[model samples]
Every structure is written in C-alpha cells, then in structure tokens.
Target chain A: MIEFKDVNFSVDNKIILENIDLTITTNEFVAIIGPNGAGKSTLIKILLNLIPNYTGQVFIEGKLNSEWLKTERIGYLPQKEEYDTKFPATVMDIALMGIAANKGVFARFNKQDKLKAMETLDKVGIKQFNNAQIGSLSGGEWQRLMLARALLTGSRYLILDEPEASIDKSGVNSFFDLLSELHKQGKTIITISHDLHMLNKYCTFLVCLNKTLHCHTETEMLTADHIKNTFGEALKLIEKDY
Target chain B: MLSYAFLIHALLGALLSGISLAILSPFVTLKKIAYMGEALSHIAFAGIALALLLSLNLSLVTMLFVLAVAGLIGFVSRFFQTEETNVITIFLSVAMALGIILISAKKDYSFDLASYLFGNVLLINKTDIYSLIVLSVVNISFITLLFKELFYMTYNMTVAEVFGIRVKTVYYLFLFLLAINIVVAVKIAGVILVTAQLVLPASIAFQYVRKLKPAIIISILVALVASLIGFYISWQFNLPTGAVIVLVEFMLYLLSLIINKRSKVRN
Candidate 1:
C-alpha cells in the first residue's frame, strides 16, 4: 500500500536518514527495530511527513507523497499520550475525536458515529471504560483506548509507534491479543516495536536501521546478527546478559 | 445588578473572557506552555505600562505590541525546540526583565499592580465590554473552524503534518489565540494573577473529563464560579477584587489536587 525508494534526509546539513527503500504491502505487520537515535523513528516520521524537506520518493496507493493528506485510510497512535492523560476526557470522547476529525467546527456528530465509536472501543476491550475518564484508565486500558481512537477513523491501515511501550507484561499479552483481533479484521498493521520475540508470531516483515537502512523478510532476517550490527557494542552487553 | 447598561457590559466581558480562556487553557496546560503564556502576559503588562506613560489607550497598544513580541517569541522558539524548558525560560526571562525595566523607569505608571496581579472585575467598563465581545466572537469562531487541525497538532503534531495539515500556520494560530486570551484576561484578572483563570480551570477540567468538549465546557463553568465568588468575596471584604478571584481559583486547584491524591490511593 506504500512505497519508499531511496529516501535521503538531512537536518541542517547533518545526515539523519539515508538511501532507504522499502515497500509495505497491504494487511502486513512490519516492525522496524533499532537502538536509540537509530533513525527508526525518523523513518516513521518521514513516512508520516512529519519531517519535511527530505530527498526521496514515497508513494501511498500509487499517489505521490505530496499529494495525499491525512485521509481516513491511515490512523496514527503516538508513543506517549501524556497530553490526554493529564486532561480530563472519557474513552468514548477520545474515540469520538476520530469522527470529529471529519466534521466542521459547527457540525455535530450523529447517533451512528457515537455507536461506531463505542463499537471500536469495545473491540479494544476498553468498552467498559467507555464512560470512564481516560486519565483514570490504567496503562493497558489507555493503550487500548488509543487503539480505539485509531479505529474511530475506520482506517484499513494502523501506524502505531511503540504501541506496547506503556503496557507491562500482563498488559502486553492483552495488547498482543488486541493486535491479533485487529489483524483478523483484515487491517494493515505497520508498527515499530522493540520486542524482538514477536518476529515469528505477528511480524511478517522486518526492517532494521542504525543511521542507515536494512530490509529483510521473516525467513532471511537473523535476530542476533542484525541487533548486534545495528546497536554496535551495546548488543554485545545484552547478549552477554542473555 | 441594578443598572442595565453597566450590567450588560459586565456580562458581555465576563462571558467573552470566560469562553476564550476556556479554549486556550488546555493548550497552555497540555503543551506545558503555561510558563510561556504567563510570561507573554507580563510582556503585555509592559506594553500597557508604556501606553499609560504616553497617555494612550492602554488596551489597544497592549494588544498590538504583545501580539508582535509574542509572534517573535513563537518564531524564534520553533527553531530551538530541543528542550521545552529552554524556550519557556528564555521567553520568561526576556518578558519579566523588560516588564521590570519599563515599570521602574516610569514613576507614575498608574496600571495598578494589585488589579493586574489579581484582576479587577469592578473596573469593567463599556470599552472593555466592546473589546471582549469582539474577542469572544473571534476566538470562538477561530477555534471552531480549526478544531480538527488544532486537535491533531496539539496531540500528535507529526501525525498532523503527515496528513497535510499546515502545522506552521496552526502553530502560529495557537500563539495568536493564546495572546488574545492573555489580553482578554489581563483586564479582568490583571496580568500577574490571570494564570489562575487561564490554567487552573483547564487543569481541573482535564482531571475529570476525557473528551475535549466536556472538558472545555466544564472549564468555563468552573471559571464562571470562580469569577463570581471572587467578585463577591472582594465586595464583602472591601478588598481588591482581583486578589479575591485569584484566591477562589487557588482553592479550586487545591481541591482538584486532593481529589487526584484520593483517586491515586484508590487505584
């Protein structure tokens, strides 16, 4: 559904991302893993068009990168939802923000929209917290709420950055279940996760970056080699502990 | 309550400021830009000081000059967003320093430190009412029209950009709304103490509401209550109206903090 060919980007003449080429197929779950400051997040930002003035060719569904706006085809969930946490809003209210996105300032949401929002929240397992203030939700519940917010767009593609970061071990299992359910619904899931063990279960494709680009399929990608190469000496310490 | 003309003026100004501050407060608190917004008010105070020194319409001059300086601060800070605290500190220092300089230079600058510190509701006049009406209409319409873009930008700016939202335009627009709210509030609450009205309501609203509309609506209601109590307390005690209003807001904030603690213990 998306294509990036030879993307090169520099901030203030310092190379941030370089020579990146990859294609994200429809209904595929791909994770790009890397160490801190490894350009993994940069790739996501570039794809989302957060970082402008980049050198590359990005096409979404055969359209030029510059031509597309944030349509209902894609939904984004950021790493940290610190803003909404401190604010007093209910789960239903945030999910409804996706619907409000399409409406004008004066336009009111219809009954159908509210019902759909509730349904989305239910799917994420936060339906019980539908009326509960989002700040009052636990970490796991909040992540699910974020998913519901994304699903409110009814988008086929979900771009989640560090979706499981906030959740704990028990929460991660539930989050995995949530992802599995979303996957079953024939949605395209492109997530950037640090969890390496998920390559066999959820991730069908993989990309690794450390100020450069590397792409491999599940069959060809080796875990230890790629991690060591991308992370440098840090991976050695991790391997020693493991 | 007795005089028709005076009452109308008071109501218009209060409602206009109440709504404007309601919408602007979330942005200030959520983005952690309260410090910057607070400093801009002080900068606005400096402009008012200068206008009074020249015997000009303090309101008009304050609006134009603060907006200009605020825009400059906005532009400069975008390039230096490595640390939010840095931007906050830089703007706060500049604004505070300039305000002190201007105030100290003029021996008879009659911009009462008390009213500006807390806000003088009793000083509400016809001219202030007219300005509030214009500001309220403008702020409400602007926020309504750009709600989606602003929502996206404030929550996840990168996502907003990817979706082709004019982030720079929206960013500057946010600054403008903030500047206007500061001006609207400065007259009623006074410059230094307006932070109570601007941030406390939203922070309290945020603690209870998970949705934007309810949060905003509740914040306005909260502000209205605080404003009324403030006016009443000052009248009863024969004290500065602004300080009373600020104190009312302080109590609300304290109440919220206690509630937060109780909830955390329960969780």
Candidate 2:
C-alpha cells in the first residue's frame, strides 16, 4: 500500500508535479500513464525516494518512503539506458545485486542469497542463461533478467518504470502476462508506462497523470476523455477482448 | 642485486604498486573514469615540484597536496553538476602548468625532471615503501569491504541509489582510494607513466574475459607477470624500470587483442 499526500515537486521554479494526492492499496496492479514530461517518471522517482525535495509526504504501507527504502521493502526496475554492452558481468552477477541490500555493503553473498537468485531467475524463465554474459542477451531476455532481479528482493511491492518501452511488440503480451501471473500470486505491482492498451488489459487500476493527478480508478473507468486530458491529445486505445 | 638495499626497496615498491593498480584498474575502466589517473598524477607532479622547491618532506607534502586536489576534483564534479571528464581536463591543465612553473623557477638543486618523469628505481627509499604498504592495506580493505556496493554502482547507479546505497559516499571513497594509489605509485613509475599500471592490465583482461571476477583475477595475474618480467629485463639491460614494465604490459594487451580476434574468427 502507498499514499501520496498533497505532493508538489518543482525544479528551477517550474512545477513538474503539483498538488498530487493518491493512494495505492495492497495487491493492486497499478499502471501510471501520461505523455512525455508528464511527471509519470517523476512520480515514480518520488515514490522510490530518489528525490526528496517534494513538498508533501509519501507513505509506503504506513511508513515513509525513505524508511521503506532503508529497509529494502520495495524493488524497482528503472527505464533502460544505453548500458555498456561489453561490461564484464554474468547473469548471476547481475541477479545477485537484488540481494545486495539484505547482504549489506560489507558482507559477502551467502549460500541462501545465491539460491534465491537462481530460483528467481528460474521463475523468470531464464535460469539456463544464468552463466551467460548479460550483454549477449536479447531485449526480451534482458528485461526478464531485470524482472528476476526485482523479484529477488523478496519485496511485496514491485515498481517498474516503462518495462515495455524497449521490448518488442510480440514480447509485450507475454511480458504483461507474466505481470498478471505475479499479480494473481498477490504481489502489489505499480508500473509506469506509455502503452495505454497494455495498461488497460493487464493492470487492475489506472492512474492517469499529467503534471497533476487526473484520475485514479478501475481500469474500466479510464475512458478516451481521461486519455485526452492526461496526454493533451487524442490517441488510439486498442480495444482487446478480455 | 640482492645485496643492494635500494634495489630491494624498489622491487618492493613495484610489487605493491602493481597489486594496487591491478585492483583499481577494472573499476576505473568500468566507471569510465580512466582520465582520473592522468589528472591526479599531474596534480601530484605539481605537489612534488613544490616539495622540491621548499626542501620539505616530499612524500608528506605530495600526499597532502594530491589529497586536496582529489577532493577538489570530487567537489567540482558533484557541486557544479558538470561532466567529470571536463573537470579533470581543467585540473590537468592547471596542475601541469603550475608544475612546470615551480620546477623552472627554482633550478639550483638539480631536480632531475627526467627521472621523475620517467622513473628511477634507485631513488625509492624506506619512506616510499612505508607509504605503499599503508596505502595498499587501506585500498585492499576498502575494495574488499565495499565490493558489492562498487559492483552495484558499476552495473547501474540508479538501482544502487534506489536501494539506499549512498552512491555519493561510495563515489567519494573511490576517489580517495584512487588518489592514495597514485601517490603510492609515484615512487615506482613516476607521475607521467603511472596510469599505465592502472589501465593496461585491466584492458588486457577485458579482452580475454566476460565476467567481472575472472577479469579482476586475470588483471592481477597479468600485472604480476609483467612486473616480474619487466623488473628482470630492466635489471639485465640497465633500462628504466617503469618504462620497461609499462612496455611489457602494453605488449601483453596487444597480444590479447590478437588472441581475441583469432578466436572470434575461428568461432
């Protein structure tokens, strides 16, 4: 569960998010949607406590976001950047980072951490690639690896930023299907995305955002008007048979 | 050679510097901060020149001076929100200019700039060895303790920050270790050629491996072999120790490149 109380974030005298207030309940799959520069990522960043300059408070399950982060209660997958393709890291090495907080800064990974990482990789369907170079993986495989890392934290709430942006169209359905499966297993998932169709089909709750909160309700309540209001234009929202 | 005290000290300094550089290299390469060595060494050169001019304890003065410069580099890069390479370039130019001015202004003590620029094993002493030991211990401890944190930072800074890892503090700590290593290495490789020790072995290891742990182990082995072979070659030919070691490492890197290419073609 999460709550944003009257949060206002600004930069250099320009308001990026203004008077934002929302609540996310437990075991709810939330998809935050907006256009470019619409403060979707900024909202996610605030939730992760990456930027602490906001005017209001963000509480995660009755605790402050900062405290939650300190306890490693939340897991995140940020938007992919142009990471070094030739970086000398194996799949296991990257996956082990999920347990870094639990192990602390000074301690080495114990047998349990390695086993959990391996199990999570198996859950993501890429356990066979555990020894493969991370740079050699396909986009879908890499995203799955990152998902494995997120799941490895043993956190109830998994927050992802644009997990589908880099994924191919054919891969998007399977990816959301995975998230749906995880949600059925009672994991609270909050994700930011530009893809409205996937958000409508897979996500239980939709929070339309645009520098300010526009709507937060069931996915069925997100109409074309909400889309126009949030994105400042009319865009096609594909209707899929559920 | 065994009877000479200076040779023994020089050998000890070389071994320690080689080990430290082997550890620092992979991080530097991964972080894309290789220019740090060049910038910090230039600043240390200025520190050395000032120490010679004032007839002070060269090691103490140089360490303090380079530490201050390292702090400034960290501060400027963080505070001004500028690219680290840009800040390093500015500091490099200023430090080199000041070193030249300081060395030229006081020409009485016969401060052989060439020996400092290249290196002279005979010049190493007990004080340099002591600094190397202390700095090496600190560096090893820092790397060992903060191994996971550093590895996470290298993989992705955002993930590290989100996990409450104190990315800034880790970065500053790394810069501190780097500054200390540069100071410890000066007695063995001199300012101009020292960064080769930090860069070449890691580069060679990266050419042959795709895993961080293996790459690190390979880097240390490469550095050890090069230092040992180069030490003997320099001793036999009466050549500069630092230059010979760097040359040997560079040649190994070239050989790795060829080996990698041939393997790729065969595959």
iRMSD per prediction, in order: 4.1, 1.9
What candidate 2 gets wrong by more than 4 Å, as runs, is: A234-242, B1-3
Per-residue lDDT tens digits for candidate 2, residues B95-178, read 889988999988696867877777777787888788778877887788788888888777778777665665667887898788
Give one digit per residue, the lDDT tens place, for model 1 in A1-242.
Answer: 88998999887888888888888888887777777677777787777766778887888888865566445346778787546554544677678776665664446668988889888887788788888866688878888887887777667878888887767777776787778778878988878777776544677777777778654566245566676777777653322111
Can you give the DockQ of every candidate in the order shown?
0.30, 0.58
Indicate which candidate wins on DockQ: 2
- All models: lDDT? 0.72, 0.84
- Can you give the TM-score per candidate against the true fold? 0.78, 0.93
Alpha carbon deviation, residue B75, candidate 2 (Å): 2.9
Off by over 4 Å in 1: A9-16, A33-37, A70-73, A104-106, A136-140, A162-186, A194-197, A218-242, B1-27, B79-123, B134-174, B203-218, B252-267
Share of native C-alpha contacts between chains A and B (below 8 angstroms) recovered by candidate 1: 0.33
Per-residue accuracy of model 1 over B1-267 as CA lDDT, tens digit each:
456665456545655676678767776676666776787788887777677666788778888978877766666777755565566567667766776777778886656666665666656897777777777678777767776666656665654444344555777778877787787678776777777677888888866655676777778788788767766676568766656666787798889888978998999
Worst 10 residues of 2 chain B by lDDT: B159-168
User: How displaced is residue A119 in candidate 2, in Å?
Assistant: 1.4
- lDDT of the structure predicted as candidate 2: 0.84
**Could you give the DockQ of candidate 1?**
0.30
